[model samples]
Each structure stands twice: as structure tokens, then as C-alpha cells.
Target: MTVHTAPAPAATMFDVRNPGTGDVVGQYPVHGEPEVAAAVERAREAAVWWDGIGFDERRKRLDAFRGVIARRINQLAGVIHEEMGKPHGDAYLEVALVLDHLAWAAKNAGKVLGKRKAHAGPLNANLGATVEHKALGVVGVIGPWNYPVFTPMGSIVYALAAGNTIVFKPSEYTPGVGAWLVDAFSQVVPEHPVMQLVTGDGSTGAALCRAGVDKVAFTGSTATAKRVMATCAETLTPIVAECGGKDALLVDQDADLEAAADAAVWGGIANAGQSCIGVERIYVHTAVHDAFEAMLADRVGALRAGADSGALVGPITMPSQVEIIRRHVADAVASGGRIVAGSGSIDGQVVQPVLLADVPEDAAAVREETFGPTLTLRRVEDMDEAVRLTNASRYHLAASVFSKHHGTAIADRIRSGMVAVNSVFSFAVVASIPFGGVGDSGFGRIHGEEGLREFCYAHSVVRQKFASPLPLMSFGRTAKVEERLGTIIALVHGSK
Candidate 1:
């Protein structure tokens, strides 16, 4: 007798909508485990050819990819704007910043990862040592939606420069942006699928993590990071997570209040405040608290959030984030805080930028990552108090300090991964400095020399130039040889 088996269910497709206009920008398949695994398999085969090419050839191809991005920057920016709900100009700026990083990674990869001579210690003087960083096969990159082009490129570009093929799983909200990136890369390096795209939701990302990729580079919330970590733990796969933050901005007594106010408004509300390193808290020195607060209120009050061309702030990209913003605002007001600038109204996905004053330290608005166009301001007795309050948060991702005379001193006291002195978010623009945080912000880094090494593993080699006189590593060693070695070591190292 013969038995009939049921067929597997078909994979579903989802629409990408614009938060500002409520229009479907694109539709993508919810790539499941099978599709994700197939993409990784292709990447693995491509990795072999990618790694075989010398650094000079890789640099030339990477430069060509950079050229593709530069020539079509406006088209890519438009996709980012439509899919992620940011202003078109801001999207252009985001894509423009990525060009600098792409160039830096391409130009510096050889210098950073090339083989170099390593010193052998006195005990092994007759041995020669060398070290280099080699590609770790295929890499899985899980990107965020807020800054779609910029954030993921921190991983994709660096990993590519280091000679690893990539399988990118972009956030569901902005799959079009990811597709555009992959297509553009293919135009430059058409020989193989050096970089590929797999669009889907959380399940797709989990599948990539479990698909035997050499490494996973993820950027998202701390809560979600835990889940990714758990999934990767199943296979003991290594990962680098760049998570969320509740960053702070400090104002010293001698700070330029005008500049501080400008930085606070831009840092707190830009991109509708969806940045992981966005300024969510402000600690001002009492001497200039009143003046700085007045300037910040005036500037923020003039800004508006909408789909209009002139609106400085855009709609919240993710719909669920609106509820979080609403809850934080209500909690701040109910806990004795007053809205200093905004109307505190949530109209659809457009949340007017709100500035809160006198919120308690333990309030949800102050302690949590609001992820909205909101700011909570508090006055402190001095710079010492400012530093203390700034370092109190569980998220130590990034911070900005404004002081005419003591900018560096105050920045040094704050405990965070990257600090901007007399400015805001400047560190992220520079390609040489590393970006990532300690504690809840997640471990491992992206961007800079450290980021290049993140996707590669160190390879060490030792060669013997001559036999050691003492032959410490030999089985034929005798007591007399050991005695002479002890006396020589004591003579060399006994005196401090």
C-alpha cells in the first residue's frame, strides 16, 4: 500500500509601508529557514573566491562599489526616505556619510590586516614570529531600520574589505534599502555573489544566526539581542551586537549656551530621535540652566513633524514606537514634569518634539530608551554633579559635553564608549574612531581598525632561525642546562 504526504506551506509576503503617508512602498518575501540557508550556502562558496583575491584587487573592487553609491546617491536616498520615513535631505546626508567609511575601509584594509613581524621575547630570541588577520569565511549581518544605509554599512563594508562574503538580513521596515545596496554592489563585482540580500522579519534573522555563518553582526535593542544571543548559542557561533542607548548631553557653567542649545535640539530630535546614540537626557550646570533651557525651548518649539517638505522632523518610522513615546510623556507629566516646548500630542505617527523639565531621575522617561523626539532636562549644582548623573544610566553608549574651557576634562569623567566634546555625534562621522558600547549597549565594535579586525581572526606563525643554546623545549634537557637558564633569568630580571 502507498501513503500520501501533505505539502509544505507556502512562504508569505509582506508590504513595506511609509509611516508618513501610509502607502505601500514595496513588498518582500518573508524568507524562511530554507531560503536563508540557501543564501548562506551561496555566500560560503563566494567567500572562497573573495578571499583568494589579493588586497590590491579587493581595494579596486571596493572603490568601484563606492563609485556606484556616489553616482546613484540620490536614488538610494529616496528609497531610504520612502521606506524609513526620514526627511529626504536627512536621508541624503546619511548615505553621503557612508561613502567616507566605504573609502576608508577600502584604503586602509591592507595596512590594518596585513601580515607584520612580531617580536620574540628574550627566552625565544632565536625564533621568528609573524601575525596577520585572515577572513572568517561568510558573515551574517542583521541591520536596523532607523539608519538603514549608515548603520549596517558599518558591518557590511568593513567585513567586505576584510575579504568575507556577506548575507545581509535587513529590518522588515526597510527591505527596499537593503535590496538597493545589494544590487548596487553586484554591479561593481559581477563575478560572484560576494554580497547578497535576504529580506524578512525576526524569524529570518534567527535563521541566519543558526545557518552556520562564521559570525553574526547585529544592531537592535538589548532585549532582542538576548534572543539573538540565545539562538546563536545553539551552535556556539560568535556575534557582535550594537544595541540601544539612552545617551545624555551635559552643559558646564562656562559652556557656550547657544551652541549647547543647538546641539541638544539637533541631537535629541534629528531623524525623529530614532538614533541609538540620540541625546535623551540633559544635565545642565545651575549657573546657566535657565539661559540654556530658554534657548532650547525656543528652538525646539519652532520645529514641526510632518510629511510636508518644510518640516524639520519626520514621522516615527515604526508604528509601535509611538505608543512608547506617548507612555513616556504621560509618565513624565504625571510624575511632576512639565512640557516646556511641545504640545505633547500624538497625531498619527507624527509626534511633535517635546522638551520636558523637572522630571525625576527614576521616571520611565529618564531611565528608559524613549526612542522618540523627546528630551528630559535637569539642572545640577556643578560639572561634578553633571558627570555623576550622566554616568548613572545603564546605557553607556555615547554622550556629549559642552564646555568652553573644560570640555575634555568633563568628557573624560563621563563613562561611555564615545564622547563628543563641544559638539554632538561627531565621533560617528569620523571613520578612524571605533563605535560600540559597554554593558547593556552590547559588546563588540563596528567601524575603525577594530571593526575590520572584528570580521577576521588573528593568525600567528613561528619559525625557528637557530637551535636554542639551552634547548628548553627539548626532551634532552639536563639539570645543568636548567641551572644555567635560572641564573641567566635572575641576572636579567632580578633588579626592578
Candidate 2:
């Protein structure tokens, strides 16, 4: 007779707390390697079915999924506000953007990734070629908490639309929001676990990278991205890392100061300045520096960060971020940076908006990713200096240029991935454009046609239409045939 041993205990559990209040919003398991592996295996099976359904059928399912999210948008928004400390209205707005992107991804995936004929060169006229994008099997989405519903969906929705199943590992700080999203999708497509949620911290994320998923799409701090990259390297797994940014906004002498100031304030302080694309640095032409400063000061001063329902700004979602904000402000002031408006202090997790001026270019607040409700302003001699300073940052993520006549011209000069002319972060809302950055801001894209293709591998097909008299691919070709092929290549390419 054999004795049966008791099963191992379940994984450790953790609590997700509201940043505004110290209250526990929800509790979830810290999924380990075993659970993550299981999720990946399940996703692999689901991906087979998901991808086999063909683009038209997949589009229908995605449309239904989008409808689910739209119908209970408020519910998801509530979860976002509770888990991440964004204002209720702001949370709603974030979900609205997600809905638009989801709809676009669903409607356009077939057109973007469908098989299409590719013209064969004259030398290969006997062959017919076509190109198609095939799903990567399964995708592991490691999401961020700042815009829980919007940011991850950029990868999740597009990957799903491309016919890949997903194993989403949301930020531990906002696991409840992740749960809600998965639940919503299940309501529509309950046949299989097309979208699964694995809740935990960095270990869980690492497990995902190593669990043999087709690809991992991550969004978080640049430092953390490096770690994730290293983990993915262990498995030779590819990843799309959407990291942090110290984005800038440029103001020209001819800009509409009123519009520029309003956009800057919203771009820098909304969501308590947690956005990766948020404007943290501003370079203004000296001609309108004073006027613009005054306008910005008035706007920032009127804004407050609080836990109240009507407050425009909310508390810092991650407690550790408060210290970073505090340090940046203190360092700026110590380096002779003056607070033009609002106080540079932290009351618990609530950091009042601070507009700093005269900070040195090398100051931590200026050079670093100060993910806080603060903006550093500097006056430049001209638009030349404005563009120079804007491109100097190591984080070439995104930027905004404000000029009545030269907005596009100035935007084209910036080294970032995308720029908005006379506006802030507008490129993100447009469904056709890609969203990403160069350098430390991370690689790969998350929106538009590029985004849908990001989750797929190109599949090329070539069919021989007829036997070629001069076949280059056969080993039995005669020397005369090779000489003729060489002559053809020289004729086609040597002149160019």
C-alpha cells in the first residue's frame, strides 16, 4: 500500500490597495512559474483555435469583445480609479480611448494583415509571390498601472485582432483592473480562454517571458525594461518594450500662448503626470517666455492634487513614486530652480502641481524621468535653441511643438518617434499612426498598422508558374545558364 501525500500549498497572495485611501481594493494570488506556464500552455492551445478561425471570424469575435468593454465601460473605469488613483472622469476618458482603439484594431486587422499579391521582379517573372502576416501563437502582455485599461489594451487588442491568444500579466498595483478586463472578454467569447490574466509582481512577469510565449509586450520603467529584456534573452524570446520617457514640449514665438499653455498643463499634470508620453520639459522662445510663464503659472496654481471626488489631480499611485517626485523637486530647488507656481512638497501621496523655472539643463529634474506632477520650464534664445534642447534628452519618446506656421517643420526635426503639431499627445488618439519611441523610451510599436503587425511574423509564399529555361535555383544548371543569370543580374543592378 502507498500513502498519498498532501498537495503543495497554493501560491502566496497579495493585496491591491487604493492609492487615495490605504484601503485594500482587492486580493490576488502571486502567480508563480507553474501557474504562468499553465496559462501559456492553455494560451497556446487557444491560439491554435483562435488563429484557425480566419481573419473574418476573428474580427467578429474582437468586435463582440469591444462591445463588452463598451457596455461596461463605467465598471472598468471604476476599477481603474480604485486601483490606480486616477480621477473617475479621467478613468472614463481612458476607457473611451481604449474603446476607439479596440474598434479600430478589430475593423482593420483583416485589411492590414490579409494575404496580398507581391510583384515579382522581371528576373523571377515565372514565379508568383504573395505575402501574409501570421499570428505569433501566444502573446504575454506585461501591463502598466498608470493607464491600466488603455495602455495594455494597445498590445492586447492588437495582438488578439492579429489572431493570437493572450496571457496578460498586469501590474501588481492594479490587478483588479486586469481581472475586470479578462472577465469582460470572457463574457463575449466564453468558449476558450482567449484572454487570460496572471496577477503578480516582477517574478510573475519574468515567468511569462520564460514560459515560451510567442512574444512579450511590456510597458514600465526603462530600468525595469532592461531586467525584462535580460529575462527574455534567457529564453531567446522576443519582446516589445514600451518604457518611460522624459518627453518635452516646445513653444515658438508665434505660437498661441493660450493654447500652448493649456496643452502643456494638461499634458504634464493629467493623471498626476504618470503618462509615459506626458510633457515634463518645456522650451519656450524668449520673445514670449514671460507671458507663457505667467499663463502656465495661473493654470498650474489653479490645479490641486487631492482625494476628493472633484479634484482634477489624484494621489501618486505608487507610494515609492512620491519619493522620486519629492527628490526631483528638492534637487531642482537646490540647483537654483525657482518654483514659479504651486508648492514643491509632498503631503503623503498627494503631490501638488509644481511649475519650476531656471532649472539647469543638467539638473536631475531636467535630465531624468521625473514621473510626477511637475514641469520644468526654460527660456531659449530662438526656435533653434528650442529644438536643440528638445532633442538633447536621452529619452527620445515623444514631443509636442507649438507654432502657428512652423509646427510641422519643427516637429520633423525632433528625434522622437512621433510628434504632435500645435497639440500634445494627439498622435496617440489617431488610430492610424504608430506609438513608440527611439533610444531609452523603448523599441517596437503599439498602435496602427504597425501595431497589428507587431504580433505577427511575415509569411512569404512563392509558387512556380512555369518551368524556367534558365533556372537559377537548380544545382544541375549548366555553366551557360549561370553565365546568363550573372549577365541578367549585372544588367538589372550594375547600372543603378
Candidate 3:
């Protein structure tokens, strides 16, 4: 990893360490209050240059940024691997997915938010009407460490494509990756600080919310998101919060256990199971629970977490996360849940896959988001019961359903904002679909057309083709005009 000389009066003082070795990989400038405030203030000015360039010009710049990302994909991935401790392949995949989102956002921003004519209503028939989406100035983004590139890039690239400058605060755990992204973007648009970085701890993130940015897009835990929202609320800044999810996977009686096991293991244990949309709960049909558990256990037991190619998963990305994983495991075992395989713990940071069965609904393992290399297996009477248990959480981010007959129906009923019917998180990978949740999981959206719109506001325009003798909006309105307006409204909207 490249190390720049530590600057005096460091704006940011974040430490980056390899999760597996506990070795200090790097130290980043933890952008402070004044610096972050300056960045946002600067981005506001940059927003003018970025937005004034127009859509076509912005597309050209975005395409250039894409070339930068593509050219240094592996180099960027190496930084990600060193910072977040994920497998090299996983890191590459994360950046690759982000490349797709960048391309989609730049290509489709115009169509999704362009001006369109609309009915002025019968009351205003004399005037024409249209609405066009406009950029929302400077946007601040707080990102997570897991999928460090893909998740944050979802907001940063889309915001940039929408003609808004971005000041991003990536998770301190992966500040290096965030810094790398902002630096690369600068190469494409070197004239302005259109994309800037704020590196620090939670307080730095709070500083961002308090900054005068137009909107804040935060992706993290529900608890932290609440704090971030409250901070942003002081200024009434609109925010898009993508919080945690204790997502579940339901298996119908006629479903395939082998395929379900494959998805469950991949979704739950991949990235060391740190995914917000990762499968933490599994509700298998009672008749098939045993077979399904056996298959899941066999698959999970074979998998290992290491920095080597022989193992599929890497270590826990955060040191604090290891304890959280251990707590959830111990809690589940103490609550009468049986560990079917791999109890947990390893040399430095590796955590072996664990499968828990008979986990009580009241246990933290079942309700809370463990966000680790663990899975809770349960059996329900039918799909109805499965849906009931799935929607029991305060979070509704993402979910997965495995069923031969009722996958779509079950998925539709679940309250999550996104779902993968026969797969895991396929919705997020598809650049056209929106990814976000409602309720405690937070509001607004990112990715696809929705992601682009979140960074902008609609501007309506109305022009009259020809003036009517009867203008209700003016003081010239008379009894005859009122009667005529009522008649026109009734004719157009009443029985018709």
C-alpha cells in the first residue's frame, strides 16, 4: 500500500489496519469539522461547475471517470483487499459491480429525469404544464465498509451523473478505499473538487450531517442512522438512509434444498457474512427442515475464512465485529439453539461458518442482525407462518425466497424494499432496480432511476400556447366562467 507523508495538523486521523493480521496497514487524514465543512462548501461551488456543464457534458465527464475506474480496477481492488480484508476476487467483483452502476447512471440520467408535459387540470386549461428534474446541489454520502466500493459508488456516481457535487465519508474501517475513489475521480475532473472525501470516525460523520449539504445519503446500522438523521434534521436536510437488515430466506415444501443451501451459504457467509442484506434467518418447511439443515451444515462446514485462495471467505472486516459475532453465537447457544457445525473463532481474524438450529424467535440470533458468519435455521408450518416471521423485524431492507410455486407471492407480501426470488441480492446487481427499505430501515432510494432522482428535484414549467378569454387564475373570473369551468371538469373527469 502507498503511504504518503503524514501531514501536520492532520485534518483526519483515521487508522487503517488489516483485519486478519491486526497490522497497521495505513493511516488516513481524518477530515475534521472545519475541513469537512470546507469540503461541503467547496462542493457547493463545484456543483455550479458540474451542473452548469449540462447533461451531455456531464455524461462525457462521467464516461471519462468510468475509463479511470476500469483502467485501475485491479489496483483499486488491491487497496480494498488490504483495507477491508476481503478476498482479492471479492474486492475485484465489488469494484466491477460499481463500474456497471456508473455506466447505467450516466447513460440513463436524462431519460429518467427529463422534462415531460402533464395535464394542467380542467381548472387551468388555458395554461400548459411540464415538470423537469433538477440537480440538488451538493450531496453528502456516508458509506459502509462491506462492499465499500459498490455501495458508496451507488450514491457517488449517481449523484455526480445527476449533476450534483459529492462529499463522501466512507466508513473509517475502509477510509483508504474511499480516498482512492475520490482521488481517481479527481483525475477525470481535475478542475473542480466535484467529488471529495471526508475521513474520520462517527463524530466526523455527524459533522457531515451538520454541514450545509443539500442532502445526506447514509448506509449503516439502524442505530447510527437514527443519530445521523437527527443531526441532519437540525438543518432539515433531506436524507436517504440505508440501514441494516435481518433478512430471511423461506423454503417451501416443494423447493430444492440443495439450491437453497447454496444460496444461503453464499449469501450468509460470503464477505464473512457482513452484508446488510445477508441471509441471517432461514424458515424451511417442517418436513424439509432436517434435509435442508443437513445440506446447509455440510456446505458451511466445508467453507473456511482465510486470506488464502484455498478458503472462499476472508476475515471479519472490523475488529469490533468479531466480538459481535461471538456474542450472537454464545447467545444463540445459551438460548437452547443447537450448533450444527463450526462453533466459531480462529487464529487472528478468521471466523468459521456456524449453523444454528432450534433458535428461539425471541433470541437475538433470530431477531437482531448478527452480521457475521452465522445462520439461524427454523421450520415453519407453512408459507403463511414463514411470511409472518419474516416481517417481524423493525428492518425491511432486503429478503430472499426459495419456493417452487409461491416464491413471487411470498416475496410480494414480505415488507422488504428488495427481494431475490430464486437468487440472493440479484436485485441490487441489476442496475435498473431500486435498492432501499421502508420503516426503520429508512426511506428514499439509491441505484437505478430512483438513485439518480434522489439526488435531484423536479422543476415544473408551464407555458400557454394561446390565451383564453376566460382565465380563472386572474381577477377577470366571472360567474359564467365558473359555471363553464365546472361543466368542463364534469365532462372530462366525472363519468369518463
TM-score against native, each model: 0.97, 0.97, 0.95
Provide the global lDDT of candidate 2 against the true structure.
0.91
Question: Which ranges of candidate 3 are over 4 A from the true structure?
Answer: 1-8, 346-348
**Ten contiguous residues with the weakest lDDT in model 2:** 1-10
Task: Identify the runs in model 1 with alpha carbons over 4 angstroms from their true place.
Answer: 1-11
Clashing pairs in 2: none
Which pairs clash (backbone N, Cα, C closer than 3 Å) in model 1? Answer: none
Give one digit per residue, the lDDT tens place, for model 2 in 141-173. 999999998899999999999999999999999
Clashes of each: 0, 0, 5
Compared with the true structure, model 3 gives a TM-score of 0.95
Checking candidate 3 for backbone clashes, the offending pairs are 11-30, 12-29, 12-30, 12-31, 13-30
For model 3, state the Cα shift of residue 205 in Å.
Answer: 1.2
User: Tens-digit lDDT track for model 3 on 12-68?
Assistant: 365789887778988877666787888888888878999998888888888898899
TM-score of 1: 0.97
Candidate with better lDDT, 1 vs 3: 1
- The worst-scoring run of ten residues by lDDT in candidate 1 lies at 1-10
Report the C-alpha displacement of residue 449, candidate 1, in angstroms. 0.7
